[model samples]
Structures are given as C-alpha cells and as structure tokens.
Target: MYKKLFLSCIFSLLAICPILANGELDSCESEVKRLCQNQTESIKKTLACLKKNHKSLSIQCRKEIERGVKQEVQTKPPTGMLFSGGGGLGGRFSFIPLIKYQGENFGPLGSDDEDKKTRLRRQSVEGSTPIGKIGGGFISTSVRYGVTRFKEDQFLNNGTKVNDKLEQLELGINFNRPLENKKNINIRAQYGYRGDRIGGSDYNYSLMTGYSHPTESGRGRWQYFLMFSNNGPLGSNIPIPGVMYFYRTSTMNLLLGLPVLSFQWTPENTLFSLSLSTFGPFYNLEVNYGLVDQVQYFIFSRWKQENFFLSERRFEEDRLNLYEKVSGVGMRSALMKSSVGLELRAGYSSDRKLYLGDGLFNNDRGSLDLSDTLFLKLMLTKAFR
Candidate 1:
C-alpha cells in the first residue's frame, strides 16, 4: 500500500509544473506590450505640447519632435502670422509714397481767353521711427521730400505772350519733444529748401514752442503756439533778377494763435474730427480764425482667398479773414500679403483777395477762381525683425 501512495504523489507534482510554466510565459508577453504602448503615447503627446507652447518649450526638444511630425503639419502652415503688424521694422518704421497732378484756372471774368495752369508732382517716401523713451516723454524724427510746381500766367504786356513757371524741391525734417506728461508743452523745429525755376532758391526755417490744456470733461481744449520763421534767398545773387518780391525780402515773421476747441468721435473702424482755431499776427495783432474738419471711414474684408482693406478720407479747411477755402477727398485700397497699394484723390480750392494791386496805389482786386486736382499713387514697403 505504501508504494502505491508514493507513485500517486509524483504524478500530481509533474502535472502542476507544466501549468505554472505556461502562466509565467503569458505574463512576460503582457508586460512587454504595455511598455511599448506607453512609449508611443509619450512621444505623440510631447510633439503636440511643444507646438502649442512655442515660447515656453526648449529649443532642443522642439527640434527633435518636429522631425517626426514634419509630414503631418508641413502642408498646413500657421494662419494670422504673416504680415501680422502690417509690414515694418517689427513696429519701428513706416513709409508713405505718393504721386499727384493738379490743374488751375485763373483769369479775369468776361475775358475772351482764360488762363489755364497744370502741374505734375512727385514726393519722396516719408518715414518715422521712435528713437528712445525717457520717463514720461518719447522722441521721434520724421523725414520727407516734397516736390511741386506753380504755373504763372503771362501778363498782357504790349500783346506779347510770355510764360513763367515756378518749380520747387523741398527737403524737410521734423522733431518733437513732449513735456508735462500730457503731450502739451512741446517744442518743434523745421527747416526746408524751396528751389525755383526762375533763378535762385529760398530757405525756410522755423522754431515753435507751444502748450495745451484740456478741461476735465475733455469736451473743450485750448492751445497756444508761438512761431518764429525766417524766409530769404540763398547763394551769391544779391538782388536776384526776376525773383518774386517776397523771396528777395528777408523777413522775420511771427504767428501767435490759440486753438479754441476740437472734437473727435471714433466708432469701430470710422473716425471723425473737427477743430476751430483763432489766430493773429503777434506784431500787428490782426485777428483771424480758421476751421478744419476731417472724416475717415474704413472697411476690411476677404475675397477670393485674399485679404483687402479700403479707406476714404474727406478734408475741408476754411479761413474766415483770408476768404480762402479748400476741400479734398481721397481713397486708398491695399492687399493683405502684397506690399502694394493704390490711391486716388480729388480736391477743389478757391482763393479771394481782400485787397490787391500795386502797394496801396491800385484799387481793391476781387476775383473768384476755381482749381481741381487729381492724384494716383503707388507704394512699396519692407519689414525688419
């Protein structure tokens, strides 16, 4: 009986050893699969996280993952990143280029022939950049080139027709420094050169110191500006022949004035402004007043997968004592990605003289005249990082 029992125990041990071996093999396979899945998931998450946080991520890590996901994201570039700030030195500098043409009609009424005048104009690109910021004040400089023409009608002297033209090239610089934390109490200086076709050139220089104080409600503001200017001819030509009388005489001119009230209203993409100023000569103290108004409207839209913007501006100025008025309207359009644009403008001006003729000898000259102008402009721009 003892021999039979011992043989049965041996059989039972052999059977259990095979079952334990199979279970161990299955567990090892399962552990290998879990580790492989975890690694794959981690790599995918790292790539997605890096792109979402471009500035926060480490450079080395981003580069490594970008290689793996290049195919998936390459076809789809980021939107709203190109031309983000409208193309400049990363918010530093900007420029404006313009071309214009003007026509003028001046003559005595009821005359058989009316004098017609025309001008072709071009101006250099103008630009501005911020230099530095100090405390509550900032400094900026602007440079520009202005070219224009003035046509003179020939006088009827002995029935001989003569034509005269005035051409000018103006290079200008403008500098401003603000004080008192309000942009009030500022100083400005400017210098320019005017070249004439007749003979010599004129030099213009001016310095202005001004201040403004706005009421608490901001509905009304008052400003006072004092300006000193020098206008005279340059070069070795003393008593230049055929030069305008005003150019030959070197004079120190003074302008003192107060801008009484100004108002502005802006809603969404539209802006409107109006201002009235009362001015006079500081020496003779002649009283004169002027009114200026402006309005701008703009719209932004997308069509045919291209972004576009359009704007229009209307400007008007009236001088009461001088009896002169000018008004103009302009329109501009541009594409989103291209650094090209088109502009059109039209203007009308009328001038009247209260007193005219030879140095207090002739009678008062009263004549009404009209002028019209049109302009087509093109622009080019670049951006810096």
Candidate 2:
C-alpha cells in the first residue's frame, strides 16, 4: 500500500514541477496552501493538494501553468522589453489614446528562463512643478523625477552582477502674455528638457506655442486653448486643441473640457472629484479631518497613472515586444494653486525573450508583461496667477 501511494506522488510531481518553475504559481498560492496545508512531509502531499484544488484555480493561472506541460506550446516573443528616447513625459496628462513607445527589454529576461545573464535597472520622477502661471500665462514651470532600482542581486550566467541605476529629471517652462485684456485671451509658448542626471538635456527637449481664450457661452463661460509642440511623443508634436468651462455654484462645481474634463462636488468642508477621459479613470476625495491644527488643512488622496509605451515586433522569425507603464497614488494638502505630497510607484524589465503569451492583462496598458520595480515619488507644485 505504501509503495502504491509513493508512485501516485511521483506522477503528481511530474505534472506540477514545471509550472511552479515558470512563476505562474502565484495566483494559486492560497489554493495550494489550503489543499496541502498539513502535507509538509514530502512532494506527495503537495502534489495531491494542488490536484485537489485544480477546479478552483483562476483561468489565467491555470492556463499559463498548463501551457508548459504540452509539447506543442505556441512560441512567444523574446523575453525582456526595453525602451529609450524622450518626450515620454508629455503623455503625463493626456486622456487620448496613443501608440506607446516600445524598445528591447534590459536586465534579466524571463524570470523562469535559465542562463540569467544581462541585468538592468532604472529610476525617475514624475510631475514636479514649481512657480505656476503669471498674469494668465506668463511663466508655467514644472519639475519631475524618476528612478530604475534594477534588481542587482540577480546574477548572470558568468556570475557577474550587472546591477545599475538610472535617474531622470524633467524641467519645463511656458511663457505667455495677454493678447487682449478684456477677452482674457493669452498667447503661450513652452520649452522643456529631460536629462539622465540633474544638469538637464541629456536626451529630450520640447518647444511649443499656443493660445488660451475665455468666452461667453449660452448660460455659462468657456475656456479654450490650442497648441503644438515640436518634439512630442506623437511624432513632431502636432496641433492639440482643448476647451474648458469652469463654473462653481452652491453645492457643486462643473468642469468641462474637450482635452480634459472633470467634475467636483463640494458639500460643506468635504470634496469629491471624479474624472474619466481618453487616458483612464481618476478619483479623489478630501475632508477636513483636523489631522493637523484644525486650520481646514484638508487631507486629500488621489489615484492616477501614466501609460508610457508598448509595441510588438518580429525578430529572427520570432515575435518580440516591449512595454512601459507607470502608476501613482498620493496624499496631500488641498490647495487651489500649489500642493505638496508623497507618491508610490512600480515598473519592470526583462532581457532575453519577448513576452509571447497573451499576457496577464491586455494591450490597453501597452504590454501585459512587467516586473521588479518599486520606488517613492516626491511631488511639489506652486501656481502663480
């Protein structure tokens, strides 16, 4: 009887080991634990646990893991997607969809693949601006930071750690003057630089010109703007048009814009804002919790993201791809012109192969594959009217 049980365990190991090695086992962690909770003695128990819980697994988790078991597995792109260039920061506030920037992956390739060789890492900042508008559109300035804390601990085939850190900074300014004082119309021009270090202009730069006009609508007011940048991520930065109507009443604020749209409901000292556009969805809320000195130091929280780029290619008859994505969340003191706070972010990279499978998510994010990135963001902005 013992011999028979041992043979059953052996067969089970044969079925599960490859999937576990591929890193597709995370989704089923809880299921695995519950099924094999007390079976720590040997492989036999763990194998039985997983098999028993097979029916309860997530479709994605089961599909990826089982794909490896078959001999006729469909090919996937090379592991590791990489990207380089500039203007990636311009998409910062865009709500429109765009062709994401794509490149070769750096650092280690697939987390499961053998012969781990080349390693890569990076870091940077996002949306940091100082000194807001002056006399309508006099000087609009901003500063942002970023970083790639590459996985240095992972070694390569030759045992050499290729751990490296990349830091980036972006500084931008816009100058403007009123075209007509009575109409509240202003002409604006902008210049910006993105660099590897802090000195500025290591890789990217931008120049643009535009106009802003506020006019009377049927029952309210309308704010209008039109501009073109020279080095935008979308080719040569063509004409981008936007409009806005900012009106506030007793219990609510109506904010409508062609390029950017948002709605806010402020009842008493509490505020709630909801926004959705070409980019994605954004939600925020602020309330005076008296967390400070009770000076109406309203506490605010926000959820937003910047989808950098994603692309697919064919190499040596095999598919290749790259993905760049950024997500952020923060808490700050509510100020109409300036606000300061802390944000957290995550990103990833790979070297050897392209992400071939359909990916855990969809192409809406540029690529479904991302890994090994963690960092904190410092944000500060000041607006001058």
Candidate 3:
C-alpha cells in the first residue's frame, strides 16, 4: 500500500523529534527574570536577550514576545486535528517538504476548443506526533503525502480522462480529556486515500467530538461538536452540529461557532499580524510582517475544496471534485538559528475547478475549468515549537 503509506510518514517523522516543545517561554516569565537574567545559557540565549531588550519589555511581556516571534516565522505545520483544526492550541512536531507549481493554463476546457495548456504539479510530505498520556487524554498523530500532476490532455465531456496523476494519503488522530468541570473533552479522527489513474480509488472518513466549557471568567471557551465527513457537500454527509467560542488574551485569538470563524491578532510592539479562518474545508486569510527576529513576510488568501471517490463511474453517482481560489505572497526564514526552515510562495489562481460529482446531487459527468493561473511554492521545514 504505497510502502505502508511511506513507512507511516516516516514513522510520524521519527516520532516527533523527541517531543518538541521549546517555544513557550511561560509567557515571558517575568520578562525573563527582568531581562535575560544572565541569559540562562539557553532557550536560544533567552530568545537572544529578549530580542535585545525589546524596548525594555512589560505590556504583558511585550505581547508574549511578539506572539512568539510571530509564530516563529509564520506557522504552517498542520494536517488536521490540532484542536480539530480551528486555531490549534498547543502541541508540536513537524516535518514538511513541499513543492508546487501551476503555470500552463488555457482553461475553459481547452483542447480543440483551443487554449490547451494545462499544467499542475505538487509534491508533499507532512508529519506530526505527540502521543503521550493515553487514557487520561492527550494524544496526537498525523501523516500525509501528496502527489499531484496533471498535464497535457484534458478531456471530459464523457470521454473521461482529465489528465491523470493524483495520489493522496492521510491519517490523523487526536484526543484530549480533562473534566471535573474544568472542561475539555475531545476526540478526532481522519483517514483518507485516493489514488488515481483516470478514475479509480477511494477511501475516506472524518469525525470529531468536542466539548470545552471553561468561560466562567477565564477569557473564553465553549465549544461543542459532532461532525462527520465523507468528503462532505451532499447533505454534508450526516452527523453535524457545532458551536464554538474561543477567545484568548495577551495578543488575541478568537473563534466563533457554527461553520466556524476564527481570528487572530498581534500587536504591542508589533510589525503587523492578523489572521482569519473558517476551518474544516478551508478558507483562509493571513497577513504578517516582521522582517526580523528570524524573518517573516506574508499575505495570503485561500479557499479550498477537495473530494474524490471514483471507482470507475461514467456518471451514475460519480465523484471527483477539486476547486480552489488563491492569492499569495510569502517569505519565511529561520534557518540561521535553525529548527530548519524556509518558505516561499507566489500566486494568482482563480475559480479553478475539476469535476464529476454526486455530492451535491448528480453533478454533470464532466467539467473542467481552470485557467487564470500562476502559482508556485516551495517549502522545507523541520519544526517542533
């Protein structure tokens, strides 16, 4: 099975590089002992003497050290279940390597209709781990693999074949527990697979269970859930019900329920930062800036969708869908002091699509419309913070 899912994503990236966690300086412990108390010989020399005395600290320890150095150079290490994907809460371990391209276009179903340019490429890898205290709750797992390619020939008006190549794999797990009215209860699950060679391959799953509570004057909390997925979109594949409300302090974090909505903010000795999200099937917006403290620069926009299941179907309840919208600009660095990182992005993609559906009730047998393009990405990372 693809070499056991590539050796289970390299054994969850070598088991989460020894339990990563070196980036939560206890909310700036008293401004790091009132400013690098002897630089404690580590934690990167107390974060380089608190960014060299970041204007002497205080305002809640300089907004938690500028929101942890802008999420240590713009975060990106998720493959589901970091608090059920809605603004992750804590836990670490990562390994990323990606490459993407989108060039060549000429959509609106080219070939003979003219403009037959078609192109797309992708390569991916992801990992995650942290499976500690089991029964008492606290476990994690993740794995992913992607391989996409679509070039040349693009047919589909019943002639099927819309440029082949597609292979995906995923696995996830999550769990949390804590009660006694202190609130917390979680459970998550995921499984996915999709191979392809013109139309064949399937396996899917998703689930969630939540409970959060808190809020008796603790900044925020209150989440509830029950979800299901079979790659959604047709009566949303059953089990559904949700609620949310997260809100944290010291530099913000917010989330508002049903069909989730998330937000993030960072100020106080800032150099810009912002975020937005509508979890699950993705919808994002980001902005960041802080060209130092390990570099960062970003601006993003996204909307995504994916669904696949096609055991050779020429129509009758077919499925294979993909849609995307993009906008981008990116830069992230942090290799010099190493946790190993790098990122870059370029964009412009619009109302893309590829189809054959049954999840929105019998979608026509073929559809392809992908043009307005120009995409690029490159990433390399090894993180645990």
Which candidate leads in lDDT?
Answer: 3
Q: What is the C-alpha lDDT of each candidate?
A: 0.25, 0.31, 0.54
Residue ranges of candidate 3 with Cα displaced over 4 Å = 1-113, 116-157, 160-214, 225-237, 243-245, 254-263, 276-278, 281-283, 288-298, 306-322, 329-347, 358-369, 372-385
Residue 48 of model 2 has an lDDT of 51
Candidate 2's residue-wise lDDT over 223-268, tens digit each?
5655453333222334656566655443333556543344434344
| C-alpha RMSD for every candidate | 29.6, 24.6, 17.6
TM-scores for all candidates? Answer: 0.38, 0.40, 0.32
> Candidate 2: global Cα-lDDT?
0.31
Choose 1 or 3, whichever is better by lDDT: 3
Ranking by lDDT: 3, 2, 1
